[model samples]
Target: MYETIKWPDEMKPSRSPIHFTNELDVAASVETIWSLLTDPKAWPSFYPGVQHVQLLDGHARFGAGTRFETNLAGQDVHASVQEFEPMTRIAWGGYPKAAEHSRAYHAWIITPTANGCHLWTEETMRGPHWIELAKQAPDIYWLTHEKLLKDIAEVAVAREKSGA
Candidate 1:
């Protein structure tokens, strides 16, 4: 019984303050979902909007103190793995800078549920130019977040059907 997730209202309007979440019930188990979520190599394939991803340090396995680099919406983002609770949760946060604006903090969290899993991306943006950038690119961040959730869910379902 999978459910389609929606973007929260707080993330819609340009001036509403930065916050967003998306969740879906993947057909695969928590372990399967966790593998897909933490693997940097699969990110670009699954979430096409992610321009680039590279592990800066640490093993590919999830854990605190790991670091990674990502380019999202033309911004060069750097993040450190802040939390990793095995199959239960993973979170990372850091700053991302672009030519025009920057996000002070960007975070992604994954949580397991009885049926499947939940995923969310939240960013706190701060820059002298953010207000203007937000108005011009309202959907860039939020749309990418939504796409990530959808792609992971679909991949999990496919994996389950194939018995992988």
Candidate 2:
């Protein structure tokens, strides 16, 4: 029995002040979408803002408790999996090494649909300098996520067709 996980207070849009959410109706199974979402290394290939991902613990697929680091949107982020639900959701949060105390939480939720599934991704950024950073580059907050979701859908569809 899968249940929707409650959003942590820190990750809540109202609590964070700077938040963004993007959803995509993908023509792929929840498992397929989940696989792509869990693969950190593959992210840079499709997500423009991501430069690299290095796993500090666990394998290429991140599960609960897995720790990793990434260069996202020109920020060095050290993150660990805070929550994971197979084929349903995964969320992570950590501070950007580039910034003194800036922190970010990103989550993905997949819900089964008649044709396929609905993929929703949201992110929240908070800290003393977060607002200034958001003001400096607001596009990274939402636009990149939209592109990432689109890319994931295309990959999932292709993988399904090839029977991979």
Candidate 3:
């Protein structure tokens, strides 16, 4: 079971990027998954931890130069579309400015397989304060991310069953 889910290296004291991949056997097609993944408006509905999200003056269609904002973990995170491929991948760098203890870049890639789909979330972090913060909070990031993944997978399955 553990082999199926992998966390990024950044979760460790080394402060590297965290890479996680999970495959789900959704009955939905690639287009269905792509629509849900790219739409910021649908996020809070699927991912409960997301307090709010706003599209910041960009078209919702996938492409370069797209931007959006989200209230994640009580932090107002600003992210821009670094890469956007319809029905395939979307990447963004978060927290544009370098804050004292936090920095992140997150990306999601969606691939259609014979059975269902492959979804992956990659997050990279940089900052000397990460280890200290982790020591104090202990798995805050890990738990939050794990929940997000679970929520996404659950919603996808539901959508598939509903013929969405």
Residue-wise C-alpha lDDT for candidate 3, range 58-142, written one tens digit per residue: 5765456677778665567777777677787776766633353566656666768787777666555556444445667766666
The candidate that achieves the highest lDDT relative to the unseen native structure: 2
TM-score of each candidate structure, all chains considered together: 0.73, 0.89, 0.74
Better of 1 and 2 by lDDT: 2
Give residue 125's error in model 2 in angstroms: 0.8
Write candidate 1's Cα lDDT for 9-126 as tens digits: 3322254365555555665677777777778876776775686678877577546778888876556777777656676556565556453343444445556677766665565555
Among the numbered candidates, top TM-score falls to: 2
Residue 77 displacement in candidate 3 (angstroms): 0.8
Residue pairs with clashing backbones, model 2: none
Residue-level lDDT of model 2, residues 1-164, one tens digit each, is: 11354566766667887888899999999988887778886686577678778889758689888999887766788998888989888989888886758778888888999999998888888886667877887776788789888888998999899998
All candidates in order of lDDT, best leading: 2, 3, 1
Ranking by TM-score: 2, 3, 1
Please report, as a residue range, the 10-residue window in candidate 2 with the lowest summed lDDT: 1-10
